[model samples]
Target: MLVRGKADRASRPNLLGDLDIPSGLSASVGISEFTYRKGQEVYSENDPAEYVYQVRKGAVRRYKLLSDGRRQIGAFHLSGDIFGLENALVHRLSAEAVVETSVRLFKRQSLENGAETDANVFHRLLSMTTKNLRHAEDHMLLLGRKSSVEKVAAFLLEMDGRLTSAGLLSLPMGRRDIADYLGLTLETVSRAVNQLQREAVLKFIGKTHREIVILDRLRLSSFDIPG
Candidate 1:
């Protein structure tokens, strides 16, 4: 998605909201810029966690690999979201850019060192890690327990909130990725999407099927499984 000025700013959800970072910590850290094209791997599973990344533009996906090369996408990171915050020095999951994305990366060692000296930064990092864990837990429940239709509805709501701009929501990932994430087959994912469009809950921009327009949020939520 192309963005300009304030419109671009709104696309990102701030990770640093009300979180205090020591002034000294800011001066000690430096950021490197990296741009990734669609479907580019940011870092692979088992790679050394050298940096913590903050998205300056676009989205990312973090996923786990099974024994047979199947991947289950754990989360989708939108603008202003942080990824590559590892629980250890090595990454547990692989991360990839969903589009032409730019990220500001800071050395993990520097952050760790700064955190030792700054209580606020330490607390913020701990809190962020907990939040990521919680999100992963929630996604696991959704994937394991939700029906195919419910899964699609949940996915729509999430994408709508994250990527929609000017009342249009465009998905960067393909059907195979969506199926793997939702724990459904590709045909099932396509069928659910078609059903939603027919039911007037959503509409597509064109034959491409990438651009989605949600027509009725209330109806969409009604399809969500019992909490």
Candidate 2:
């Protein structure tokens, strides 16, 4: 189980907390929750997009498999974050648990029906869709234009904001996951992180690569490519 600090209480997972669920439809929507083991598939690419999911605990990684069988990770969804809200009928990427994860699932058909009769539900759907679009746009820029060091820098800064607790950042994914997400080789990602550690920009916690402490946030940010 994940341990959270007092400062993280406001961001803790609460099903429907970020969503505007219409009152009358709440009982009829067929909402259910399930747990997925670490590295287990939540859904595969091209699967019918029959449900929307929100992370209640742990983390999820969404990725696409190319024809050559190479994997490209798109994004990581943390606790309280909603995902699988694709516009297409089929999922464009597959999702898997980075750790043992719990998620709340909503039947997409039920949600669509609710949106048809409720303005609030419709607006909420639009807002969630827009948020996903903005993330995708930023990811595209990071992958296509940023240098290797810049990509790694931006990634560290992102995780620092999302998963840091008491000034220590714990990464749920491995170096390979980070490499795929940044469109770089695993060695390159490791090199970038080691360089940061040597420069005193960040320091590793314990002997694990997954835990880090940022020592110089300003110096780290300086390496990130500007928008």
Candidate 3:
């Protein structure tokens, strides 16, 4: 990873919100910047976990390859999200930039040092780890029990809250990424999305139709998707 220098807090607010790093603890820990191109590998599985990362811009996808050549996306880390907080010495899953992305990185050892001094830092690290584990458990349940339409709906609801900006819900990742993340076929994801469009629950905007706008959130919340 190349260091692109550091950013001041004024330039990037919530630079370390995920860990809720205290000002004192954070001041002692230096942060550096790194940028990755779209589809660029951030880090591969088993790579040394020297640093913890926070998305400064764009998004990231973490996934694993199955035996039959299928890819299962475990999570999507959007702007202001912190990832790569690992207890193990190596990354458990591989991560890639969903777009041309910039990240702020701080050494894991520095964080460990901070945790040793501050009770708040230690509890914050433990809390973040627990949250990650809970999310993984929820995702596993979604994959094991939900139908394709249900999965797609859940995914849309998630992005509706996370990615909506200026009345436009722009998705950084495409259908294939969504398919892998939702554990559904690409065709199935498309069909479910189309069904939602037809029912007036959502619609794509602009000539490129890359942006989404949720129209009837009530119906979307309560509607029964046709199987």
* Top-scoring candidate (TM-score): 2
**Local distance difference test scores for all models:** 0.80, 0.86, 0.83
What's the candidate order when arranged by decreasing lDDT? 2, 3, 1
Q: For model 3, what is the alpha-carbon lDDT of residue 132?
A: 89
- How close to the true structure is residue 138 of candidate 2, measured as C-alpha lDDT? 85
lDDT of 3 by residue, 75-98 (tens): 999998889999799999999999
Taking the tens digit of each residue's C-alpha lDDT, what string does model 1 give over 1-227?
Answer: 32222335445444334336566566556656677878888899999999888877778888898889787888888877888988788999899988788876777887788678878878988988998999888787678655788988988887887789999998877788888889789999999999998998998888879998899999998877656
**lDDT string, candidate 2, 16-64, tens digits:** 5445776677787776777788998999999999999988888999999
The C-alpha RMSD of each candidate to the native structure, in angstroms, is 4.2, 4.2, 2.7
- 199: Cα error in model 1, Å: 1.0
Candidate 1: where are CA atoms >4 Å away? 1-19
lDDT-wise, the better of 1 and 3 is 3
Higher-ranked by TM-score: 2 or 3: 2
